[model samples]
Structures are given as structure tokens and as C-alpha cells.
Target: MNDHVEKMKLNTKKFASIGIMGLLGLVVIFGSVYTVEEGHIGIVKRFNEAKSQVNPGLHFKVPFVDSVESIEVRTRKNEEKMSSSTKEQMPVTVHVSVNWTVDKSSALDLFRQYGGLTQFEQRILDPRFRSATKDVIPRFEAEQLIQDRATSIQLIENNLIEEMKSFPVVVDNIQIENIILPPKYIQSIETKQTEKNLAAAEEHKLERQRLEALREVNTADAKAQGIVKVAEAEANAIRLKGEAEAAAIAAKAKALKDNPLIVTLTEAQNWNGQLPQTVLGESGMPILDLRNKQN
Candidate 1:
């Protein structure tokens, strides 16, 4: 009975050891196999040194001896606000956005150099972006920055791209979202614009008044010309009527001079059919007394 009890205790100890080993083996297998999701790349690091890079899907590494770091290889966006100055030394605030992506081929090298994405952005990308923005912004005046915002943004993007050429990341695009100017300057510009508009309006009003005055002058001239024409027409008509009357009088005078008996004929034609009561001669005596003969 004592030997059988000792044998049963030994078997129990073996079973426990086997179970523990199996659990450890299971843990190792699960730990060694890792899946890299879509749009991500895995970097295998052995003893804290970057060894290799793996693409998306299941990948194997030595358990407890090697570690995998997954990094997103897809496009990303980051926005930053920077305080800068214009060429005229006007202080301004700029909001900028950047679209960037990690190079999948350079993942291991990037990890070896910068450790991870967070460190990469903090140490390299952020500083470079700030530097590029500050460097390019001072080349433009405040008014130019506001009026030609697209040109200024393009310049900034170019400078940033040039600055980032040596880095492991790809800079897809850069956008300048907003440029904030001083309130007093903005107010002054608005006031100046208002004054300019008012001056233009005043000039337009003066031009309109001048045109109206010119039009009135033209109308007066035309009316005066019409009146002068009417007076000329009336004078011509009067002159023609006087000429006609003078011609008729002259023609009558000529006819009367051509024949002296015209007056007698005219008197005979006008005389009534009646004899005179008395006729007086040069001696003032009655030459013929028709009244006595009739009696």
C-alpha cells in the first residue's frame, strides 16, 4: 500500500509538469504568430535591433527573442498652427495641413532611425514643417499673403517638399488653411477701401452732372438755332410780300401813264344815268340849265 501511494504521487507530479510545459508552448506559438492588418507594415526587431520588414497578413518571429512593430503605411493628415511674420514684419498666425505617408520599403530603416511613427513626427516632420513654413512666410507681405493666398501656399508646399526630400516619408500635399492678420490692420484696410469706393462714387456723380450740363447746353443751343431759323423764315416771307405789292403798284402806274383817257373811261364807267340840274362854265354862269328846260 505504501509503494502504490508513492507511484501515484510521482505520476501526479509528471502530469502537472507536462501541463505547464504545454501551456508555455501554447503561449509561445500564439506570441510568435502575429497578423498585420491591411494598410500596415510590420517591422521585426531582434534584441531591440531592427531586422526585417513584413507586409500585411500573418507573419512569424522568434517568441520572446524578437518583437514586431506594426506601422501604418497608408496616407495620413496632420494639421498645425504656426506663428510667423510677413515680409513687412507684420505678425500673423497660419494654419497648415499636411498629407503624408510612410514609405513601405523604408519601414525598417525608418524604425531603426526614429523608432516609431510618433517619434518620427515629433522629432523630424513637425520641426521640418514649422521650419519650412517660417522660412517661406517671411518672403511675402501681409497684403500679398491675403490677396494671393494660393501662390503663397504653393510656395510653402514647395519649400516643405524640398525640405522633406531626404526624409523617409512622402509628402503628398500641403494646404494653408487660414492666415490671420491683426485686427487693427484689417480695420484700416476696410476703412481705406470704403474711402476709395466713396471717392469713386463721387467722381461718378460729378461725371453724371457734367454730362447732364452738357446735354442742357446742347438743348439750349438747338432751341436758339430753331428760333433764329423761324425769324429768318418770317423776314424772308415779309420781304417777298413787299416785293409783290411794289410790282403791282408799278404795273398800275405804267398802265395809267400809257393812256391818259383811262381816267375818263373809268369815270364814265362809274357815272350814274342822270342829268345835272345846273352846268357852270368859266364865267360862273349856268352854261346849260337842264332843270329850266325840263320845267
Candidate 2:
């Protein structure tokens, strides 16, 4: 009995030691670790289930049952070009970028909901981008797409966000890095623009000419009116002066008619002064000497 008890005690002690060793090995295996990488966030999963979200630091999880998933928290970029969207059926190469991140506040929920971030991009971001570009660009002709690409980009962004609404992802912005139109197409557009500008300029010139003609007509009317008024004033002045002169002459004639004695003496003086020369009819011959005859 004593030997059996001692054997039992020894076995129990070895078992306890092994159990402790096993527990320690588990902690080492599942313990938290720090990453040297920047711009990354961590997610913890327990038994294939998301348990917690962690920042960029040392973290631990339940040994074998827990796992850490790292996601890039920083902005990442990729370039894409859609050729069928340019004007003139010309191929347009656009360098586009997608800015994205795992929604940190929803990280645990997201991981659990979507299983991982990788699925989010494949299921949400890429399709959103592709569908948005395809759906919106078709509304525009190739020329409008390339020529008015900024407006097109905005439309694409709005549509992309609308499409991603039911998704677990968020798009910060849809960037259009470059727009390449065929050289011929660009030249054609430029020519059209120049023609439009010329038309506008011609319209302005015509408007100015019309205004100037109107002004000239007004000026001519004004000058004619001025001349007419001046002529009428001069006519009135001359008539008034003539009336005054005629009144003066009538007064003088009346005075002379009333002074008959003075008129007769003057007639006698005039007859004596002029009758002899006409009657003699000398070498200075006169056909009539009417003053002497009247006297």
C-alpha cells in the first residue's frame, strides 16, 4: 500500500509538471507580438471568429484559438486605365487610384461580417469601381468623356459611392490621374472651340456696329433739327426787321406829304438849277430834263 501511494504521488507531480509546461508552450505560441511595420491595424480572431481590434502595438490572443490579422491602415494606391471612354472613338488611358481602408470603428464587426478585408475589396471596391466607370461613361460620348473628363470623374465618383452603399467598404475618392485623347481628336475639339470663339467675337462686332449706326443716325437727326431751327430763327428775325423798316418809311412819307410849302420851294430851286442845260441841247445833249418840266 505504501509503495502504491508513493507511485501515485510521483505520477501526479510529473503530470502537474507536464500540464504546466503545456500551458506555458501555449502562451508562447498564442501570445501578443509587436510589428515593425507602419500604417497597419490589427484584428484578432478567436476560433475563426473576430474577437477584437488592435492598434499597431504588442497584443495577445488565446493561444491556438486566436489569430491576428493585419490590415494596412495607410492609404494605398493602384493605377487603372479605361480605354473605351475617350472621345472620337479614340483610346483614352486614364491613371486612376482607389483610396481605401478598413473602417477601424467597424473592424471587428467587419471582419466577422465579411470574414476578412480581402473579400471586401474583391466583393465591394473593385466591382464598385468597375461598374461605376462602365455605367457612367456610357452616358457620355467618347468626345465628351475625354474632353469633359472632370465632370465625368465626378459623375463616376457619385455613382461609385451609390453602388457601394450596401457594401462594408468606403471610398474616400476616385482619382483620375491622366486623360489621354487621340491627337487628332484633341485638334478637332480645339478647332471647334476656336470656331465657337470666332462666332462669339463676330456677334460682338455686329452688335457694336449696330450701336454705332444707331448713334450716327441720332446725330444726323440732331444736326438737321439744329439747322432747321437756325433757319427759322433767321427768317423770323429778318421779317421783324423788314416790318420795322417799312413802318419807318411810311412815317417819313406821311411827314413829307404834310410839308407841301417846303416841297414847292425845293421844286423851284431844283427847276432853276436844271432847266437851262436841257433846253439848250448843247454838245452835252439830254433827251429829257423832267425836273424843269415838272416845275
Candidate 3:
């Protein structure tokens, strides 16, 4: 009975030890396991020094010795209102937006240098963006800054990108939102624009009238040409008719010249086949002849 009781006691202690060991193992595993969410990068450090970086997923590390810091590698946005002077020494107020992200490849390096994302932005990004805006805004006149806003924004974005190339941050976008100018300058610009519009409208009107006048002149010239052509055609017809009548008269004269007996024949035909009732001598006295004939 004593031996069986001792065996039961030993088995109970063994099982209890095994259960305790399992629970400890579970605790260690749970503590070391970490899930890095999407758009975040994890830096693993052993003894407070960075050892390796893990991409977004489930990862495990040494429970107490290895530490992990997650840094967001996603794009972040910030806006700023900046005041600067243009090339002409006119003060301008501008609203700007900056989009940026921590380069994933340089995440560990960035963390080491800048400590955290918030620090990096507050200390480095903000100042550099402001500097870039100030530097680029002065290159253009105040009116150009307002009128050519796209160009101005591009210039600032390019400048900032170039300036930040040495850093571990990537500049995604820069937008110049609004520009405020002095009231007097704005009024002057408005006046000039109004005058320019009026001049353009007047020029367009004159050009339209000029084209209309040219069309009228062309129409008049066409009508005159048609009239001249008609007159020339009528004159040619009259000349041809006159020439035909003249030719007929000439032909008749030639026929008369060729045969003078035509006139005697014509005269005989007109005699109506009748002799004169009385024959008169040359002295205008009547003459009578008596003859007897047998037939």
C-alpha cells in the first residue's frame, strides 16, 4: 500500500512539473511574438542596438534581450502657412501642403538618427520645407507667384526634394494652395487686366469689320466684271450683225457690176408685158403709121 501511494505521489509531481513547464513556455512564446501591421516596418534591437529590420508580418524575437520598435513607413501629410518676400520685395502669404514618407529601406537608419517619426517631422521636415518655400518664392515676382501657381508649386517641390535627397525621408508631393497679396497690388492688376480685355475685344471687332468690308468689296468687283462681260458680248453681237448686212450689200453690188443687163431685164419685167398706147417722136409729138398686111 505504501509503495503504490508513493508511485501515485511521484506521478502527480511529474505531471505538475510538466504542466508548469508548458505554461512557462507559453508565456515566453506569447511575449516574444509580435505582429507588424501593414504599412509599418519593425526594427529589432538586441541590447539597445539595432540588429535587423522585419517587414510587415508576424515575427518573433528574444523575449527580454531583443526589443522591437515599429515605425510607420506610410505617407503622412502636413500643411503650413508661410510668409515670404518676392523678388520685388513684395510680401506674400502662402498656404502650402507637404506629403512625405519614411523610406522603408532607411527605416532603421532614420530611427537611429531621428529617434521617432514625430521628432523627424517637427525638427527636420518642417524647417526644410519652410526653407525651400522661402528660397523658391523669392525667385518669382509677386504677381507671378499668384498667377503662375502651378509653376511656383513645382519649383518648391523640386527644391525640397533635392534638398532632402541626403535625408532618409521621401517627399511625395508639395502643393501651394493660396497666395495673398496687398490690396493695392491686387487692384492694380485687376485694372490692367480689364484694360487688356477691352483692347482685345476692340481688336476682334475691328478684325470682324475688316473681313466684312473685304467681302463687300469682292462682291462689288464680281458684279462689275459681270456687267463688263455682258456689255462686251452685246457689242460683239452688234458688230457681227453689221458685218453680215454689209457683206450682203457688197455681194449685190458685185453681181450688178458683173452683168449690166440684169438692170435691163429687171426693167423689162416691171413693164407688165404691155406696150405704150401711143408712140411719141423725139419732139414730143404723136406719130402714126398706116400699113396694109395680109397674114
Q: List the residue pairs that clash in candidate 1.
A: none
Q: For candidate 1, what is the lDDT? A: 0.90
Ranking by lDDT: 1, 3, 2
lDDT of 2 by residue, 1-295 (tens): 9999999999999999999999898777757444424566677777766777788766656666777787775665544667555333446666676676556667677777666767867766776687777666657776666567788789888887788776555678777777676788779889999999999999999999999999999999999999999999999999999999999999878977999776778788778563354363567675555453553
Residue 70, candidate 3: C-alpha displacement in angstroms? 2.3
Note each model's CA RMSD in angstroms: 7.6, 9.6, 6.6
Candidate 3 local Cα displacement, residue 73, angstroms: 2.4
Q: How well does candidate 1 score on lDDT at residue 78?
A: 82
Separate clash counts for every candidate:
0, 5, 0
> Ten consecutive residues with minimal summed lDDT in candidate 1?
286-295
Could you tell which candidate, 1 or 3, scores higher by TM-score? 3
